[model samples]
Structure formats: structure tokens, C-alpha cells
Target chain A: MTPHLTARNAFIAALVLALFLVPVYAVWIGNNFVLSLFTRIVILAIAATSLNLIMGYGGMVSFGHAAYLGTGGYAVGILAFEGVTSGFVQWPLALVVSGAIAFVIGILSLRTRGVYFIMITLAFAQMIYYVAVSLNRYGADDGLTIYRRSQFGGLINLSNKTVFYYLCLVILMGSIYLVWRIVNSRFGMVIQGSRSNDRRMRAIGFPTFRYRLACFVIAGMICGLAGVLLANHTDFISPAMMHWTRSGDLIVMVVLGGMGSLFGPTIGAVALLVLEEALPYVISVAGRVVTGHDVATAKEYWQLILGPMLLLVVLFARGGIDGLLASLRRG
Target chain B: MLLFIEQCLNGLQLGLLLFLLAAGLTLIFGIMDFVNLAHGSLYMIGAYFAATFAAMTDSFVLGALLALIATFLVGVVVEMVALRRLYGRDHLDHVLATFGLILFSNEMVRLVWGPEGRNLALPSWLNTAIEIFPGVYYPTYRFAIIVVALAVAGFLYVIVMRTRIGMLIRAGASNREMIGALGINIKLLYTLVFGIGAALAGLAGLMQTPILTASIGMGENILILAFVVIIIGGIGSIRGAFIASIFVGLIDTVGRAFMPDLLKLFLSQAAASTAGPALSSMLIYLLMAVILVLRPEGLFPAAGNR
Candidate 1:
């Protein structure tokens, strides 16, 4: 087992190395677009990783995870709009509100199991989405623009691309390290044990609800931090950030990168986002070669490929990209 | 008083519409134990079919009938091809696969019909409002929707309670192995059950097309509401679905209509106005959360064997 896990560990280390080196490569090549794109990818990777902590290891599938993204974004966007420009205040506020909402949501939703849990999480998220839409003061359905991004007191500049990229990378690495430590800790074992068999855990005299709920909040808090970065990355916030589809996308990333693995979320985020960007061009080119016409329609149908691909993944590749890679390494 | 009456009536109408959508959902979920996120896509397809066929035939009734048949066929085809293989699998698998179906169906509709929404015109005869009382006026089309939905509800009740096929469905719901033991062609029954569910969702979709234009995302918004109803009603209980659907419908419509006014009684006008719409949208969800906390199996969780 030790020998086998070495391959997986090496892969994760290499992936982290690439993440740090990306901005360097981008700066050297003067490719600002790739830098910005990877920055978004990195932020979402943090969110996906947070989701993986609960969904993959802890076995709680909260479909409303994007609510944290919205809450965190709005915390900054609304504050920035109301003249709170300090990152010190805005960032912590983002974390607190997301944590609070997740606490409330986790408490309420954790009562149910299975499909009910999925639907309840989804409903709660929709509630938040509607609330965002009703915030006429903050732009309502049109969404809000953060005229000024959160400012740090001469310590680090978020407005600088390379500096921001490194900041995100460091935070992401820190988060992963945190998750790794927690998973090996006693609390994580309880969460995992509960996920596998809550009844058995209870029979063994463990009070699993508080542990799971705490896990839920931690995941939400981490995702909330990601949301802050996301709002900073985009310089905008909308109800669209919390839409159930975005939550579904995060889930897809987790599942595709391989659930129940340390590096799955990061891999999933990169692969899914890269595919989204590339599939259109690839499909159009293929269409041009095959159909020799309807190029525009073909490009639009990239989602057509995506839908079936997801089905195949669920049916045949449940372990996702990370799992596949691990298996290949073993062979 | 008149406004209150009107809003209540509107709530009832909306509730009945939601019931039409929820009833089919409960049946499919309760009987087959499959989760189809693409259920809404079928609703969208039903509306699109109505729009296209109505345009072709220029008669609302004929187009509707054709849409129902088309939707039934589509549901049967989907069940046979994709969903049949997924029975007894993990609900997560069902969700992911059906989510994929949603993407497929939505894009297919966009590819086939273009992204712009299509509108269905009500017949000129049913276009006007009728005064049900001395002062209360309601649209004939809306009144028609209520009557049609009620009829469907009655039809479902009678079929489920009184017919042999209904007996088979109930038995299957409670004991899947028992149904197979009884020499039932489980495949055919499942397909037929799915057919009825598809037809019901399609009917709801097509019926509401004249009220709201048949748009791409119509089914999704209401689908969540249907889930709320189902969650409140209980996952596999049609009876629970009926009660929960109307309750959600009333709470949603009535809450939205009156919440601002209610908020104004104590709060500043500006504050009330600011919080009203957002608070109103949250009413059903609040109700759902309360129900989940209080009764996790839902109010009328089917007394199935599981």
C-alpha cells in the first residue's frame, strides 16, 4: 500500500508544483489571458476541494455549496458598494456570513438523509438566490460591480496579477495542507466513519451530528474564502454565482477529479474548466471537417457532448480522472 | 377583501398547476425509485411540442392532444433507452445521469427550435375573463386550468385506488419483488407508469404555456418548487404530494401577494418594501425547512415496505 500510494503522492506534488510555476510561465511568456484564466481555476479549485472534504470523505452531498460562493461574493460586493474598501473587514465578514449561513443550513438540512438531503440543500440555495435577486439596493437581477476591489494595507496588492496569483496559490496550498491534516486527525476519522455507517458510529457511542455539522461549516468557510477570491477575480457578484447549476458544476469537478482523494478537487477543477474552454473549438473544428457546415450550431452543441460525457462518467468512471490516474499508476 | 379573495383564488390556481406537476413527480419517484432531474426538461419539451403543433394545426385542442402523445412517446423512449438500465442503482447515479439528460434535452431544444421563447395563443373563445360572482372576475383560461387539473387529480386518485393497474403500481411501490413474483411484466408496467408520469408533466407544461410563454428554463424554476412540495409531502407518497403541492402553492402565491403589506404593519415602509419580495420568495423554503426539521419522513411518507 505504501509503495502504491507513492505514485498518487508524487502526482499530487507535481500538480502543486505546476500550480506554483504557472504564473511564472505566464509572466515569462507575457500571456495575461492564461494567467487570469488559471487564477479563476485556482479559486474554484479551492471551492471544489472544500466540497470534496464533505462530499468525498464525510459523505454529505450539499447541492447548495455555491450558496457560500454567492454569500461570500455578496459580502464583499455589498460592502464594497457601501464604501467598505478594506479587505480586513470585508474578507472576515465574508467568512462569517458564509459560516453563519452554512451553520443554519447545515443544522436544518443535516436532519435528512439521501435524496432528501440533496433536494433540501438545493432548496436552501434557491432561497438565497432569490434573496440576492431581490436586493434592489445592490443591483437586483442585474448584479453588482465592485468598483473598488478589496484593498490590503500596503502588504500585498490584489490588483497586481502575478502577486494575486501567488496569493491564491499559497492559500490553496495552505487549504489543502489543512484538509490533509484534518483528515488524518481524530475528528476526520469520526466524520468518515459516520459517512460509512452513521448507525454503527452511534452504536459505538459517538455523537456524529455535531461532528458532521462542524465539518459542513468548515467546508462552507473554506468555500467562502474561495468566493472572496472569486469576487476579487471577477470584480463582480450576481445571483448567478449561487445558481444550482454552478453547484452542480462544482460537484462534477469533485466527481470527475475523483472523490475521496486528496488532490481530486484540484485535478477536477482544472480538467473541467479546461474542457469547457477547449470543447467548443474542438467541436467546431471537428464539425468543419465532418459535416463541413453548420459550424456555428456545432460549436453551440459542445454541451451536447458534455451531457453524455457526464453520463458515461457516472456509469463507467465513478472514480473520475484522479481515480483513473491512480489506477494507471498501479498498473 | 376583494384583493384577498383574488389572491387566494390565484393561489388555488397556482397550487392546482403545481399539483399537476408534482403528482407525476411523486408517481415516478415513489413507484420506480428513480430520480429524474430531467423531469423539468420533459415539461419544457411538452410546452415546445404544444407550440410547434399548435402552429401547425392552428387549433389549441388538437395541438395539445398531439403534444401529450408526443411527450408520452418521448418518455417511453427515454425510459427504454437510458433510464431502464439505472433502476436500483445509487440515487447519486440517477441524479448525475438525469442531470446529463437535462443538458442534452435543453441543448437539443435549443438546437431544434432556437433559443427564443415561443408563445401559445389562447383560443378567442377562452381569452376573456368571466365574473364568477357579482364582483370577482377571473380569466376563463385560468379557470379552465383549475378544472383540468382537478379532473387529472381525480383521475389519478381513481386510477391509483380503484383500478387493477393502480393496484399493481401500489404493490410495486411497496414490494418490488412481490410484483415480480406475481408474474407481472414489470418492464411494461414500469414503462406505462413512466408514460403516465410523462403525460401528466407534459399536460401541466402545455396547459401553462398560454399563461407564461414556453421558455427554455420554465420547468427548472417550478421543478424546485415541486421538490419542495415532494419533500414536504414525502418522497413516494402521491397523497402527500397532493396536500404538499397545494400548501406550497398557497404559501408561495399568497405570501408573495401579502408579505409586503404584512411587513408594513410594524416596520418602516422603506424597510418593508426592501425586504418584502425577498422574504416572500423565502416563504416556501422556510416552510420546507420547518417540515424537514419537524418531520424528516415528510407528512405523508408512503407506507411502503422499505
Candidate 2:
């Protein structure tokens, strides 16, 4: 193989290896925090991946993708609250409900184009958020704490930290693989074709809307699964999960990792979340070095840098991290 | 009956505040074709600046005036430094860049203002209640908001319909390139438009500060409402914004006030109590969805513009 492909492959291999070893490394260091953080990263990576299917490939810039996250979460939380703790029932219900909501929202929102589409999606998500907030029985605005994780009934032990982490990692890989296959399939092609020029695709006898809608529903279902994992991972769920800002964060992950690539969302998830985790320490350390006293508020100001960094990426690195790596290989 | 009238007036006040924010958003979107998610940041900044200035000067009027000018400048500088580069880019780019701006702005506010929210106290003269109808009294400050917002709406109408700049703005919205071909300085016009938008958002923010207090993330929820107004009103159509803003404002306020009672008529007391707030919050969004289905181009699409 050429060095170009080799370098990219090597990087992917390295990333996979490192992710698989995170728990072991954490245990060696006696740091449970790292394990939990990586678990969160893997779960969100699934979300970012699903978002990428629509946004990167299908050209649907949904500002309400987090709605499904909340949907999936609330399904699990509400079900568990009502004494339905079986993963068999809870997981499927999460997926089905998320898909149903996406279907409804997709029908209404898909009629509009450009900014209207973005705004409509956002509005629908906000609608869901309000619904979640008003669910007084399930903890409402303060969120619901799941005292018992989804009971897998010996199929898997989710309460065990390492086992849960691996399950998430496995699911993340499975999603990335599923997305890769879908994007390369005819359905994905139609979605992409519509994205590039919907009129022409329609002229060529493709029912682009149905295809796009299907793609939208699938992405929502996958993201719903991620939400299921997230709720299980944290043992809690809230309206905050579906907030518009969280949607923006998912978009940022997709863009930061490289849209349209199979592994872009995963990479973006790691990069964005890791940056979120590390930037404060980096800022504080830099502050202490520059000034002689530790800047107590340095952590809170990390977003100040991240915000500009996003702008710079938009301005210059339209291809994102994956794109950047591809360029390195080429050069 | 008095309470109902009072709620209507409250609705009117909220509607007018929405118009100020939506007008700026629609102008920027309609004319320049930029999706500025950070417009809310400008609103937040306006409130923050008003709070700081009011606290410093110990005079509400002086503080609001200074805050308005400061927000306008911030808008202009933001345009020059960042947004100018983003024109003609994909709407997605605009969304992402401005999303970043939202994050940055929030952090910046927290860093500068500390984490706590700031309160903009009303002047005593504006704080008292006035009887609009016999034995039907309303807060003077809220009544003042309605009056001021209406006057600004009138001002906006006159400007957009009668003035030379308004002519240019209308022309620009309808056909940006043709006017540029006609030797108009498009860049400067865009900057001026953006600054005006900022000032208008600032005005809304400052006006609201006395009621809601200046707080971090205050701009976001209302920003969505402004978006709904623009969507319902029609992009680039000031007339639509005016009508739609009031409609949305009334639905939101009156619905929140009365939705519980309405729900209780159908649902059991327990269910009504739980669902009331949720349904009320979603009233405007439901309206927007219906509007989208019926009139995708909004109620008042600008002439010769999509």
C-alpha cells in the first residue's frame, strides 16, 4: 500500500488500540475518572456518528438531533420509573419512540429548505425539551436518577464499569461500521445526490424526500440508542440532554472530526470531549506560568478559546480533523 | 375581565420586544443572507452593558443610552472582525461560526460579570401602577414598554417605507447583486445593517432587563421566539414581523396564563396541572409548525424576494 493510505490506516489502528486500552490504563493508574470520561466520549461518539449520517452525508442539518437523545433517555428513565427495567423492553421502546418522533418532525420540517429547515428542527427539539421538562413524575427539570441501570438479565452486566465501557465501545464501533455501509449504499447515494441537487435527483426519477426521510429516521434511531447508553452510563437523564446547545456540540463534533467520513464523528467526539476535559488544566497551567498565581477561573474560560478555534476551523479547515489528516497524508 | 385585559397588555409588551429582536434578525438574514446564531449574544451583551452602566451612572436613562451605543459598536466591530469574512459562505458555516460565538460570548460574560445574574432595577417613577381602565391597573414600566416598542415599530415602518436608506435596504433585500451593480457600497451597507440589528436587539434586551434581569443565557430562549416571529412573519418583510410578533406574543403570554384552566376542562386535574406548563410553552412552536405547513414562505414574503 502507498504511504498515504498506510499513514491514515496506522492512525485509525492506533486510535482503536488506545480506546480499547483506556480502561486498563485507568485501572493501572487507579483513576476511575478516566474510565468514566472515556465512557461518556464513546457514548457521545455514537451520537455524533448518527448526526453525521444525516448532516455530513444526507445534507440534513438538524439542529434538533439532541431531541432523540432526550427521547431515548426519557424512554428509559420513564419506563424504569414505572418499574419496567428490562433492557429488552426499554431499549426497543427508546429506538421506536425516537424514530417515531423523528418521522413526525421530519415530515413537517423537510418541507422547508436552508435556514428554515435548521430553525424548524431546532423548534421541534425545543418542543421535546419542554415536554421533558414538564414530566413532573419523572423528575422534570432536575432530571431523574436511575437507581438501577437497565437490567440486561445476564446478557450483559451494565453496572460493572469495565463491562459497560466495553459495551459502549463495541456499540460505537458497530455504529461507525453501520454508517460506513449505509453511506456507501444506494440509499446514501440518493441522499447525497439530493443534498447536492435535489431538483436534479427528482428529475432523474428518485423520490429524494422519502430517501432523506428514511435516512433521518435511521440517524434518529441510532442516536436514540446512544441516549440509552448515556442514561445508563450516568445513571440519570434530564431535559438538559436535549438542549439546543448539546445539539450544537454534536454538530461541532461532526465538523471538528470531519464530516462525511466514516470515523470522523468518533474522532471528533474524542477530540472535542478531550479538549473539553483538558483545556482547563492547560489554561490554568499556562496562566500560572504567565502570572505567578493560579487562575481559579481559567477552567471556565476554556470555551472562550474553543469558540474562536471553531471559527478558525470554519474559516480555514472546512474539512475538519479527518480532512486535516488526509492532507498530511497527501503532502 | 380586568385580569384578561392586563394579560393582553402584557402580551402586547412581549410582542413588541419580540419585534425588535426579530426585525434585526430578519434584516440581517434577508439582506445579507447570514445566519447569526450569536445575535442572542448581542442581546445578552446589551443587557449586561445596561446593567453595568445603570449601576455605574445611577441613572437608568443615561445607562440605556450608553448601552445602546456600545452594543451597536460591538455589532459593527463583530461584523468587521469576523462576520464580514463569512458572507456568501454556506448557511451551515454561518450557523457553526455563530454557534461558536454564542459559546465564546457566554464564557466571556461569565468571566467578566462573574457567574451570578445582574438585576436592572427600574426607576421609581416607572415602577408604579397606572389605571388604564376604571379599577384596572397595570405596572407603569410594562405600559411604558408597550408604548416605546410601538413607537419604535412606527419608526421602523417609516424608515423601511419612506426613507432613502430604507429604499436601499429594501432593494438590497430583494436583489443584493443588482444594487451592488448600481454602485452601492454593499459592504458598508451590510455593516450598518448589522449594527442596526445589534442596536435593536440591545434595545429589546435593555427594555427587558428591568423585568427579567440581565442574566447569562437569557438571550437564547427569547432568541428562538424571535426566530419564530421571523419565520411566521416572512423573511425580509417588516410588516409580517410586526403582525406575527404580536400574534406569537399574545399566544405565548395568554396561553401560559390560561392554558391550565383550558386543559382542566378536558383533562383531569392532575393531568392538566402537569401538562399545562408544557403545552403553554409549546403553543408558539405549534403555531409555527402549522404556519410552516400552510405557508412555507411565511405570511408576508418580501416582494421580488424568496
The lDDT leader among the candidates is 2
TM-score of chain B of each: 0.98, 0.98
DockQ measured for candidate 1: 0.84
Compose the digit string of candidate 1's lDDT tens values, residues A1-331. Answer: 3444566778877888988899888979988989999999999999999999999999998889999999999999999999999999999999999999999999999988888888899999999999999999999999999988899999889999889998998888888888988898999999999999999998999999999999999999999999999999999999999898999899988998999888899999999999998999999889888986757767887888899899999988989988888787679
Reference-based TM-score, model 1: 0.97
Tens digits of per-residue lDDT, candidate 2, B1-306, equal 777898999999999999999999999988999998999989999999999999999999999999999999999999999999999998889999999999999999999999999999888999999999889999999999999999998998899889999999999999999999999999999999999999999999999998888888999999988888988998888889999999999999999999999999999999899989999988999999899889998999887566
Worst 10-residue stretch by lDDT in candidate 1 chain A? A1-10
Please estimate how well model 2 matches the true structure, expressed as its whole-model Cα lDDT.
Answer: 0.93
Error of 1 at A64 (Å): 0.7
Per-residue lDDT of A246 in model 1:
91
lDDT of 1 by residue, B177-292 (tens): 88898899999999998988888889989998998989887899888898898999998888898899889888898999999999999899999999999999999999998898
Query: With candidate 1 superimposed using the best TM-score fit, by how many Å does residue B246's alpha carbon deviate from the native?
Result: 0.7
Task: In model 1, state the lDDT of residue B278.
Answer: 94
- What ranges in model 2 sit over 4 Å off? A1-4
**Candidate 2 per-residue C-alpha lDDT over A116-156 given as tens digits, one digit per residue, 9 for 90 to 100:** 88988988898899888888888889999998899989888
Report the Cα lDDT for residue B281, model 1: 95
Q: What TM-score goes with each of the models? A: 0.97, 0.98
Task: Indicate which candidate wins on TM-score.
Answer: 2
